[model samples]
Target: MNLLHAYVSGRVQGVYFRGWTRGHAQRLGLHGWVRNLRDGRVEVLASGPDNALRELQELLYEGPALSRVDGVEIVAMADEEQPTHGFSIAPTV
Candidate 1:
């Protein structure tokens, strides 16, 4: 299993980015959440098989057609409590 923390920048807010993320994550069978941060970036944390996680990261770059994803910053989240079911859209933080 792998855990990943990602921050997607550039016009991520008000674009249904969180919903878009959840759809892809769930499709990949990842258990995690995506939410809008106060700073305008979309935050994503997910845990699943390594391959699925990698695929998610790539899909994030494409996002929804209405979005303009400028960058995706990835970080390794170790020893964190990850979700155990389907992906979800979390409240903004």
Candidate 2:
């Protein structure tokens, strides 16, 4: 399993980024949540197979059609922190 914690910046909020993330993650069979940050960024935490995580990382760079993703900062998390459920769109933090 692979765990990815990412902070996506630039034109990510107010554009259904969280929804898009949830759908994509779920389709990839990843487990975790995506939410908006108070600092005009989007935060995502996902866990799944290595290939799935990598594919998601690539998609994060593009984001939704209405978004202008500038960058994505990703960190590998410990397996112990991985979630054991479906993907979701969390409340803004």
Best by lDDT: 2
Alpha-carbon shift of residue 85 in model 2 (angstroms): 0.3
The CA root-mean-square deviation of candidate 2, after full C-alpha superposition on the true structure, stands at 0.8
Off-target runs (Cα >4 Å) in candidate 1 are none
lDDT of each: 0.90, 0.93
lDDT, candidate 2, 1-93, per-residue tens:
879999999999999999999999999999999999999999999999999999999999999999999999987667799887999888888
On the 0 to 100 scale, the lDDT of residue 55 in model 1 is: 92
C-alpha-based local distance difference test score of model 2? 0.93
Candidate 1 structure quality by residue, lDDT tens digits, 1-55 = 7788999999989888898889888888899899999999999999999999999
Going through the candidates in order, what is the number of backbone clashes in each?
0, 0
TM-score of every candidate relative to the true structure: 0.93, 0.95
Measured with C-alpha atoms, the lDDT of residue 36 in candidate 2 is: 94
lDDT of 1 at 6: 97
Evaluate candidate 1 by giving its C-alpha RMSD to the native, one decimal. 1.0
